[model samples]
Target: MSAAAEDEREEQYAFPMPPAGGWTADDLDRIPGLPPHTELIDGGLFFMSPQTDFHMATLRLLEFALVSAAPEDLYVVREMTTKLAKRDRPEPDLMVVPRKARTSREQTWYDPSDIILAVEIISDDSVERDREIKPRKYAGARIPHFWRVEKSNGLPVVYVYELDPATHTYAITGIHHDRLKLAVPFPLDIDLTEI
Candidate 1:
């Protein structure tokens, strides 16, 4: 293109693309709190899609199961923004921090190393992000286990991710059916029907 054409084209798109920058932990502090189940993405804050009755029920049931299987000492945080780095603190649906780390009073943020497992419940708003995006970030941090729940197909599917001893990245171990009859993550062995 000619110089004049190039200049005109550049002028036509003078405005910058939005959500343009990475978000830092300090930026997380600056943003106002949103209502429950909401999250920050890119550099903007937005609510996680309104949850369905089944979704809420599922989460509640899972919480109860975890509480029963695991002792009270393991601090479980719901919807907490774990400070992983200057730019990322994933609020996994459920995370269990070691009892000692949880008791530590010198911390300004939750350390990634303290987290044993990270769980995410996927809705329409988070399917792609939970499945495709979070693994890369979480695996990079060497989180031992990750779980994903989705109801998109009208079936309560579960995906379990674990780190292979030989590889740091996560690989799927098993996929569970929607039925409330199976249990794999030990101690969490209560039947789905029981929940």
Candidate 2:
């Protein structure tokens, strides 16, 4: 392929950037079909690469594990946006919220207070955000739990964090590579290797 053609293709897959001053969460809604794999972060638009097969499998596994352990009144959802502020609406890979709670008449976003857990499956496209920006934001919003799932040497590594009310930050509670056992948000266990 020609160099120019290759460059163009690279640009096509790159994340779209908003004009100066950035874009708000509302601006993202103006697009038709509400295109997937995009998010508004700190008032800016970021496009994410699609998950790999293994990543999707791990996500499904964790979702099932969380759902099976949560109480009947709680809901386990994937890719639902949480309105942290006027400019911030992040859709976690998985989230746990109250079953009866509705964030809006349209049921598009959830109120931050309603979220009990937020999970992000790390990918090459989202390393920084998943490791730093998101946890900081989730903590700032006072979300109770934040879990980061990362692939290290081809295996999924789960890091669990719980919010520290006094500091408004997440403290690492557990890190698991094989079996994941946790008591918070109710007891949960999973064989990570199977996924």
Candidate 3:
């Protein structure tokens, strides 16, 4: 492309570039009505497509179960953004957080330390990202627990992991198909097929 055309194209794009230092979590507030599925990773925005009915169904069921099992001081939320760093904010499919930490309804994202558990329900479009990139980011942020849900033969398979602070990675705790029971982040028991 010619320099003039390139300049014209750039001018037509109204969105301003991030400052030299990069974007911070505070920058997200400036974007009015940001889509619930949008996430910020290392200063770039990634938009996830709408989930399938089965995926949503699984997520809602899991959220309900977690909330029911959670203690009064802790609760579960769906698609809440977590501020992992100045340039990284990820919206896990569901999260369990302390009620005290979530008292500030004005905040767009929660601090990673406030999050006790992060869950992701995978679909065709997000299989690799949910399985790989997100776990690394969540573990690096020191979130204590992570759960990934995968569908196998039309059943939900739950993969649970706990952070290993020594290595700053996650260690597999358990994988459940028919039922899920975990002691950490409080005792959670859920029937996979119920969803």
Question: Using Cα atoms with residue i matched to residue i, what is each candidate's TM-score against the true structure?
Answer: 0.74, 0.86, 0.86
Please give the CA lDDT of all the candidate structures.
0.67, 0.86, 0.85
**Whole-structure CA lDDT of model 2:** 0.86
Q: Give the per-residue lDDT digits (tens) of candidate 1, residues 1-195.
A: 999999999987463333446556555544444355444444544467677876786677677767677766687666776666656666788877777876445443467787778888887777777888777777877778788887644545667888765777899887766443224334465344432
Tens-digit lDDT string for candidate 3 (70-146): 99999787887898888888889999888888766775677898889999988787777789988999999999999
| Superposition TM-score, candidate 3 onto the true structure | 0.86
Q: Which 10 residues in a row give candidate 1 its minimum summed lDDT?
A: 178-187
How do all the candidates rank in terms of TM-score, highest first? 2, 3, 1
Writing each residue's lDDT as its tens digit, candidate 2 over 30-128 gives 754445857889887667687798789999899888888999999998887887877788889999999888545567777889899999999888889
